[model samples]
Target chain A: MTTVAPETVPAAPERAERQRGQPRWWLYGAAGVAAALGIWAILAQMLAGGGGAIQRLASPLAVGEQLASYATDGMVADLRSSLAIFVAGWLGGGILAALVGLLLGRVTLLGRMFLPIIEAIRPVSSIAWVPLSIVWFGFGFSSKVFLVGLAVFLVVIVYAVDGCTRIPGELVRTSTMLGMSPMQRFRNLILPGTLSEVLIGFRVGLMAGWGTVIVAELVAADAGLGAHLMAVQRSYDIAAVMATMLCFAIAGFLMTVVFTWVERRLLPWRLEEQR
Target chain B: MTSKEAEALGKTTRPRTGSRHPLQRIGLPLVGVVLLIATWEVTVWLNDLDSIVMPRPMEVLRALGDLVVSGEFWDDVVVSLTEFGSGYVIGVFAGVVVGVLMAEFSVFRATVHPVVEALRFIVPFAWIPLVILWFGTSLLGKTLLVAYATFFVMVVSAAKAMQQVDPTLTKVGRMLGMSRWRLAFAVQLRAAAPTIASSARAAAAIAWIAVVAAEYVGASAGLGVLIINASTSLQTDVVIAGMVVIGLVGAGVSAVIGWLSRSYLSYV
Candidate 1:
């Protein structure tokens, strides 16, 4: 990992070329996947219910079978509903947070007045609000959306506020000294200043929103993956439950992948830093 | 504790607020609270909302007061504590063991790291239904869910901390003729302790959230159970009260972790 002098920079590619002799990472990674499956298979065998229909732990293959079934089953509707709830909640809360965060960061009077209250509420986990949201919005999409939004809002607001307030004093002074118009200052200074932090907010908010959405759905949803999970769980179909979880994990991973891709596109300089 | 907990410390402030009058420092926030309460009460009055639809601030406070004195609330709190404590300990212990293995052995890193990383994408709450099916509506299922939630964060943090141990220090250990295990435990793990321990704060936060979700799955007793029951019964005040209690406890846990990290643990 140590870097050589500028003259040695031309040799770096050769060193990387020589690294082809090293063990391939993906081979080991595939081994890792196989190992995980093997372990699950062993657990399923060990925990298999008495010769009958019940199996407490579903084998990886069984879950795969269930997932295959989902290709022609209700997974689409469930995924769509879940994604819809997640997107609405995440974006709605994120936009609101950006506004509130900017306000808190800029206005001393308002910040002083509301900072403590926000702090007090900050520690409350988003899941704790699920019941209250249900009480307020009832057992429907709105309730789940509110719950997710609230969680995302709380998570993002911190970043938003920090983004605005943490703009360097010198930067502010320089912009002011330039006699820039309000819109000019906002365009040239504020947008770039807050973009990174606010994006980080969105990233964190996504996790919070996703988690809350699952909890909300589990509690009382007519549709969505969580409700499907509840139905299968009550039926004691361990394979289906595991299959549903696989769907969830895949979805979560895809969302993260999308975010990382978006981040790289937006923050190309970060990628350059590595090279 | 990472940026999340650091931000939770709320250290950022207007540059000039430090020298502000103490009276104004506290009074301004109090005014905000008063306004919030006024707005809540006014909204209820304006809507002529039913208690089930929306509880007034006073009603929530009264419910909270009652919860504080009630044995049921205490019992639920005890159940939650046990579930969180046992599950977190198990998850952290397992995670650190596996993480250390990955650090010390390339085979482990190759075979387990990617698998764990892939699994980490799944929210722990998603496992609650599966665990319930496995262990039923008992404490074990709840504990398993919390543990599942805690495992990934700790594993990643522990591995990262171990890997980040100063290479020069390890070389020094080798020069001193320390055994491999001795070097790992005495030098590497000790160096990694602060980062790993700081990670506990974040894992604990996740564990707390998971515990609520676990209880929601099918626990007979918990803050989550209380909230769920109240919601089902259309007792909005009690539900809000439960939320307040959960929030207070969650904050207290964070504060306690912050103090521990500050006082007992030193960063390498």
Candidate 2:
């Protein structure tokens, strides 16, 4: 392999610059996890024993048990709802963004005319749109879907437009000289050229969508993991709060895992050659 | 910023499309904004919507004018800026220290990386509920939340940047008999500053979003509180005005970062 994955990729030339013998990284990794858990448990105990307002902090084991208890039907429904909103928004927004971004990138006057408007509104993130969404559609499924889609749309569109526009001038010129039809150029040249970068956009957009879900649910939602977290938090059930957060973490991790697998499968060269 | 992120940040004016006359480039976008405003005004008038439900663009502008004259707006701005500044400074400082340590010293890398990976997936914004419960919607919890989000971005970007700096530079420093610390400061840091600074900018923008979220859930003051309170009261104009301020301030933060990078990191 030419390189390791993003985090692990440091193992190459960086190894040469070490001041001494190579560190036993795996041992330290295991030690780090143990130390983290140990410290957390200790902090929980101290808070509990101290008594007072801060005494409600839950231990890791209690959080684990709380997480397991969430295997009930309601919990399943929450996960399903959250995932459904996320998948629908992500797929819908991602595909729409890919099309719009490609069109804008290919047509220079359009990108130029529209780029300023995007820049103006882009800073007002999906979270800020909560006020507008609530005003426009109340706290319904459509509002949440709109927020998530907008978040993904804003992020993915930029990456796509930037990616497609950066395609080599020589390649475009060569294709034109060969008298390729617009469809042939897009299908054979633009599609392949932008695929890897577009995938990168998709991964980042997943993060945007996930974060927006929490914001949307926090505003108002009858169900969903975010709403569940708010409910538990209000009752001061620290364990359940931690457990819900764990579910979010696990969900995010699984999404990334699935995405990375897809990314590698689709573009093996990208994984091997990324700097 | 990663090349990708920077591309997103400063992609406003495309030199690739620079062949066109400058006026058309400027005028066409101005027309789009005018068209949008005209459409918005017409839609409201034709539908006969109340200002509370859908404020005309002119009403929103008037609300913004009124907001700037009010004392509460300035107060909210002060509170929000204070939280953002403190969180961003502390977060970037700590993140750079730890992230560079992680990349430079294998011990830190091995010991801390797993813990980071373990917790990284927890949406930092999700901490809002617990933060409100624990810290009671005060600046401390808000600052911590912002710092938490900023810290992760800085740490990861800084670590990757340091690890990826040209190996030849470090080799030269080694040959010059520079101390390890000297090598890091003189060679590694200079090379990594661009990414770190850009990522810090990205982090600052994120910190604004976090502060807004934090304040929205429950807070005594801030632009978020302004938006939340206004929206609840059906003061659509005020809500939109708050949003405009948030957007402008967010854009200003990014601009400041760009300026800082060019001025300070120009040596690169």
Best by DockQ: 2
lDDT for each residue of candidate 2 in B56-113, tens digit (9 for 90 to 100): 9989999999999999999999998888888888888998898899888877787897
How closely does chain A match the true chain A in each prediction, as TM-score?
Answer: 0.87, 0.90
The true-versus-predicted C-alpha distance at residue A71 of model 2, in Å, is: 2.4
Question: DockQ score of candidate 1?
Answer: 0.49
Q: Which lDDT value does model 1 have at B69?
A: 96
lDDT of 1 by residue, A1-275 (tens): 21211001111244335434565755876888987889879878987854332247788889999999986889999999999999999999999988888888777789888877887786677777776776677789899999888888877888887888788889888988999887898788877777778887887776667877778888885899999988898888889988998898788767867886787789877545545
Q: Tens digits of per-residue lDDT for model 1 on B53-142?
A: 889999999999999998899999989889988998898899888878877876567668667766776778788887776677788777
Among these predicted structures, which one has the highest TM-score?
A: 2
Supply DockQ values for each candidate: 0.49, 0.55
What's the residue-level lDDT of A144 in candidate 2?
86
Candidate 2, residue A175: the lDDT equals 100
TM-score of candidate 1 relative to the true fold: 0.90
- Model 2 local distance difference test score: 0.80
